[model samples]
Structures are given as structure tokens and as C-alpha cells.
Target: MDAKVRNNTAHSRYELTVDDATAVAVYEIRDGAIAFTHTEVPRSLSGQGVGSALARGALDDARAAGKKVVPLCSFIAAYIERHPEYKDLT
Candidate 1:
């Protein structure tokens, strides 16, 4: 099934949803950057690219907001490295 990435503005968070019940990953934005401060996916959801989707969503949001991304989390940092299109925004 396709995954969905959505922003929860009320909490400054991003959620990656697969199907209808699973929250594959969650992240936060702060200080003009997207911070993958918290991330989790059920064991069943692991290895399904959900984390990457979450990072991408967060980075996209940052770009749309005209802000740089710090990528404090290793996963997010690695994602940025792999997706050079986001480099200029960093």
C-alpha cells in the first residue's frame, strides 16, 4: 500500500502513515530546520522506507517554508546526503 506523510501543525510534527493504523515515523521542526528528533515504526513497518518518507516530507516542508535543515538525526542527515536536491536549502 502507499504511504502518506502529513504535518500535524498543532504539535509541530510530521507523521508517516502506512495503510490506516500504523505511524511509521514522526518528526519535529525547530529553529528554522527540520529535526528528526523522534522516529519510530513498528517492527512490521521497518524496512519499508517509511522513515525516509518521513524525512523527505519534513525536508520538503522546510524547503516550502524557505528554511534550512539541520538534520540533527542521523537518518535525516543520511537522507539529505542521498538527496542532493535539498542541499541548496540546507
Candidate 2:
């Protein structure tokens, strides 16, 4: 959990760096909505919770910014669905 997920607005994504690999959750902001597009984790880092961590961080960022989230990415939709506290974010 020490890994910090940071928002890279220049690339319109949230990223987390592990030992050697990077996990990214892509997003697009337009017309006041933040649309989560995709999430990717290096195969070598699979099953280590990197993706979940990345998702959580991205959602948290959106919440803090008081922005509406459009979970276009299934992973993000599922994450919010499973986490009821975040359901109101959509």
C-alpha cells in the first residue's frame, strides 16, 4: 500500500508505480464529467491489488474534486458497484 497513485493530468490518467512496473487507469474529463475509460496493469503485477489500489485512488481524486464520475470502464463500474459508499459518486 505504500505505492502512491498519482493523477497525471497531462496524460489524463492515474498511475501507480511498483518495483519495476506501472499500473494506469485512464480517464477523460469533458463538459464537467470525468469518464473513467480503462485500467491496465502489467501482467507481471497482476493479482497484487495494484489495479484496485489504482482504481480507489482515482475515484478518491474525483470525489475530492467534487466531480461526477462516469464509470465507462467496467472495472470502475464494478468497483463502485461493490463499494456502496462510492455509488453516490456516479
Candidate 1 per-residue lDDT, tens place, 23-69, comes to 53344556656656656666767787777777777778778888877
Predicted candidate 1, C-alpha RMSD: 2.3
Q: RMSD of each candidate?
A: 2.3, 0.8
Q: Which lDDT value does model 2 have at 26?
A: 94
- Model 2 misplaced stretches (Cα beyond 4 Å): none
Instruction: State, as a TM-score between 0 and 1, how close model 2 is to the true structure.
Output: 0.96
With a 3 Å backbone cut-off (N, CA, C), the pairs that clash in candidate 2 are none
Residue 26, candidate 1: C-alpha displacement in angstroms: 5.1
Show where candidate 1 strays beyond 4 Å: 24-30
- Model 2 lDDT-worst window of ten: 25-34
**Ten contiguous residues with the weakest lDDT in model 1:** 20-29
Residue pairs with backbone atoms closer than 3 Å in model 1 (clashes): none
Q: For residues 1-90, could you state the per-residue lDDT of candidate 2 as single tens digits? A: 799999999999999999989999999987797899998999989999998999999989999999999999999999999889898888
